[model samples]
Target: MAENKSTSARAASAASSKTEADIQAQIDQLRGDIANLTKLIGDLGSEKASQARARAEKLRDDATKAGQEAYDRARDEALSMEEDLEDRIRMKPLQSILIAAGVGFLAALFTRR
Candidate 1:
């Protein structure tokens, strides 16, 4: 009877030790998994942030290009109109002088305080 009890006690101790070891192994695995997941999340966040920056830079460049194009068009139109005005004035010098004087007089009158 005493030997039976001793054998049962030994069996229980062995099972307890195995359970503790298994639980420790599971805890270690969980810690490793948590660390890996944390790293993955950080990497994903950095990649997304980099993508956003690239998109923003592209948008800024596009806007700058569009603004430059508009400026060029406006400059071209202004130069063409100036040439046309010069030709008209050259063809009718006296009329152009009179019209300019009249516009200046009217502007002076309008700006009077």
Candidate 2:
């Protein structure tokens, strides 16, 4: 009976040691997997940031080009209006001068009071 008790104790100790070793190996494998996943996440974040910066730069360039086009269109319209006014003044110089003189006379009369 004493010999049987001793054999059972030895078996239990061996089994406990084997289980402990297996658990340690699993913990080490999980740590390695965690490290790899962290690195992959960081790389993806950097790639996404680079893509966002490129998109922002493209948008800024597009806005600048649109603003320049709008400025050119407005300048062309203003030039057309100026040329049209000049043509009308050349065709009726006396009328333009008379209107200017009338406005000036009215301004002067109002200020004299």
Candidate 3:
């Protein structure tokens, strides 16, 4: 009976140690999983920020291209109008002078108020 009691005590101690080891392993695994999940979430956020930055850069490029195109078209139209005005002025200098004076007078009149 004494031998049996010693054997039983050893068995219980072994079982307790194993249980403690298993619980520690579970805690360590949970910590590792949490670390991995945190890293994955951070990586996902960085990827999204990169994608958004790329989109914003593309939009800026598009806007710059559109602005240049509009500027070019407006410049061409202005040049054409200037050529036409020059031709008309050469054909009738006196009439052009009279028109200019009339415009100046009107501008002065509006400014006086």
Candidate 1's displacement at residue 86, Å, is 1.2
lDDT for each of the candidates? 0.99, 0.99, 1.00
Q: What's the alpha carbon RMSD for model 2?
A: 3.0
lDDT-best of 2 and 3? 3
Clash pairs, candidate 1, are: none
- Candidate 1 lDDT (Cα, whole model)? 0.99
33-56, model 1: which lDDT tens digit per residue? Answer: 999999999999999999999999
Off by over 4 Å in 3: none
Better of 1 and 3 by TM-score: 1
Clashing pairs for model 3 are: none
- Arranged by lDDT with the best first, the candidates are 3, 1, 2
Q: Which candidate is the best by lDDT?
A: 3
